[model samples]
Target: MLTRLELAKDWVRDAGNFLKENISSPLEITEKTRYDDLVTNFDKEVQEQLVSNILHHFPEDKILAEEDDEKIKFDPEIPHLWILDPIDGTTNFIVQKDNFAIMLAYYEFGVGKFGLILDVMKDKLYWCDSHKAFCNQKELESKKMSLDKSLLGVNSYMYRTNSGGLLDLSHQTLGVRIIGSAGISYGQLLEGKILGYFSNLQPWDYAAGSIIAEKIGFVTLTTSGEKPRFNCREQVFTAPAYLVSEIQKYIKS
Candidate 1:
């Protein structure tokens, strides 16, 4: 598993560089759920690269990716599965040209084995297993922090809605930040920049981060108590277990 994980890391980094090189190219973009929710040619190309690499090495592994409908849909019952987001923050990739990420994770019989989130512009990769996580070549180990003193990562639009009285909750934290990318936000959390990150995310958005959260004793849950399923589009939240209770409290109120 370690050897395979190392190889996968290399694959993701190479694919990231591929996308970066083409970042300036004129990309054919189209709207998905919203005008801002975009799918680009680079996204498709990068997804193809990852899917091909993984399938060539592990021919039978199930793959769930953002851009490819023809690829194998995720199957939780499958012995091995790879959940991938070729470009996690497509809006950032398209508009700001930064704060985007390429994310991938490996699950075996529903157990997370490895996860990686690569910050493309920053050139940092965060990967983890049950034992430890690393940023680039440096090992990462973090301590839990209280909400009052800890910064949080959340969607500003959701906070604007004050849905579940979240506006009030943000006031209790050190500060609230909206980075527009789950993978990047997860990286910040791992680096101790934030105590927790909450977002309404799909499986591709949160799968890799949730696995890392588990490995590092961070919390992963949904507002209504749904667990991460294969390819479900739903609201997702992850932080430390202690912080989750407060988030749920706010939602319930």
Candidate 2:
């Protein structure tokens, strides 16, 4: 698993560099479910490159990626699975050319073994295995802070709609941040910059980040305070275990 983790780290770094190199180049962008939910030519290209590399090195491992709808299956028979989000903050990538990330997670027999998230613009590689989480290869210590004393990350959609009482929840925090990228948000959490983050996120969006965060004492839960299912989208709340119940109180049914 450690060897595979190293290989994944290398692949994600390579992909991140590709994104950086092409930031100034022209890209063919298209909307997915909404105008703001975008994908670019680079997104597809990066996904293809990472997927091809994974298959080449680990042919038997199943792959689940954001760009390919056909491979979005959770097969119990596949002991090893790789999940990839080639460009996590597409809107930010298109507009700001920064704040985006590349995320990858590996699961063996339904247990998360390794996870990687590369903050492309900053060149920070946040990764974890079963035992520890690190940023740029430096281990992160566990952090615990009260909601009233720490900043929180809430997605724009949820904040705008006040979904699940998020507006009220924000009032309890020191402040709120909306990064628009789960991977980047997770990195902040791992670094103790934010207390927690909640958003309706897909598997690839939260999988890698959640794995890395959990290793450092965070727990990922559904809005209603259940473990999230990996097969579909869920309102995921990730934070230190001590803060889960307080955050869940504001999550309305």
Candidate 3:
């Protein structure tokens, strides 16, 4: 699994480099479900490259990814599965040429084995395997901090709508940060820069980050305060176990 994890990291790094190389190039962009929900040509290109490489190395593995032909449903019967978001923040990549990420998570027999998130411009590859989490090559240290003493990441939509009392919850935190990218936001959480995060996320959006977060004593749960169902889009929140109920109090419906 370590060997595969290393290979996966290499693949994500290559994808990140690819994105960086094209940052200034003109791109063909389009909307997905909404005008603000964007996808760019690079998004498809990166996803294709990563998915192709994965199948070449592990032909039998099933993939659930964001892009053409790769957005298939997960099948638990499959021995090996990969969840990928080729460019996690496409709008950011297109608009700012930064803050986007390449994220991938590997699972075996329905259990997570490895997860990788490469912050493209920052060149930080945050990753975790069964035993540990790291940024680049340095191991991460975990510290427990109270919600009130920490900044929290919130989805702008949730904050705007005050969905499930998100507005009230944000007031309890030291501050609120809405980083448009889940991969980047989770990286911040792992670094102890934030105590928690609440957002509506798809499987690819949270899979890699959640695995790495869990490796460092954080728990990713549904907004309802139950275990997350990774097979579908859901409202998700993540924080240390001690802070769960407190944060969930205002957000969980």
Candidate 4:
């Protein structure tokens, strides 16, 4: 019998392979909110496959996935839950054919146990299970970068809000990047390519990545500096603890 952790890892690998097999085919795409926010047939197909696979293997486990509107409101008191993002960078997958991910996280009684973020094109996977994080099996460490030295990610939508706090954080960081995918941005953070990521993200987008970041000593919290609540309607930010502290000053100032 596969241990729970082993089952999670196998599911991720199987899903990644499924994605790669279909990557080259023409996709049936549709707009979600706008032309920029897209949903592909593959996205739904993959989500269904993942949800089915997990449920079949672990009928008692709760699952929350991106394509479904039915939220799995598990008792935080429950021992096991699975969070999945079948295709994290759907825009990139549709237009650029690269930079998307299959992300998954496992939690035991509200505590994160494992995280997997797979870069489908690069064939690289980032993972952490209790002890350490690895990129393609090479162990990774999160280094603290000062605000001025940090590379920050801001959702393009935030640019429209004109919140002074957002503007100030953008100015303080070493640079700002608007990656179309939250999973990719979080993957960059895990690989130490970027110092911080701030966005108004949904649960599937952040759940898996947050687990990896927290396991490797990065901070995952809301703008209010509280632990993020999954399946909620609130926005959250994940970053290095020092950078988060620096950004919070702007929010208060």
Summed backbone clashes in each candidate are 0, 0, 0, 0
lDDT order, best first, reads 2, 3, 1, 4
List TM-scores for all candidates, in order: 0.93, 0.96, 0.96, 0.92
lDDT of 1 by residue, 42-147 (tens): 8888888998999888888888787876556566578988889999998899988899999999988877888999999999999986688889988887686877
* Position 90, candidate 3: lDDT: 82
Q: Candidate 1's error at 143, in angstroms?
A: 1.7
The better-scoring model by TM-score among 2 and 4 is 2
Q: Where is model 4 more than 4 Å wrong at Cα? A: none
Task: Report every candidate's CA lDDT.
Answer: 0.82, 0.88, 0.86, 0.79
Tens-digit per-residue lDDT, 53-95, candidate 3: 9988899888988775436667666699999999988888888
Cα shift from native, residue 21, model 1 (Å): 1.7
| Candidate 1 wrongly placed segments (more than 4 Å) | 70-74
Structure candidate 1, residue pairs in collision:
none
- Model 4 agreement with the true structure over 192-250: per-residue lDDT tens digits: 77777778778778888888888777877776667777856445677776566667876
Question: Worst ten-residue run, lDDT, model 2?
Answer: 69-78
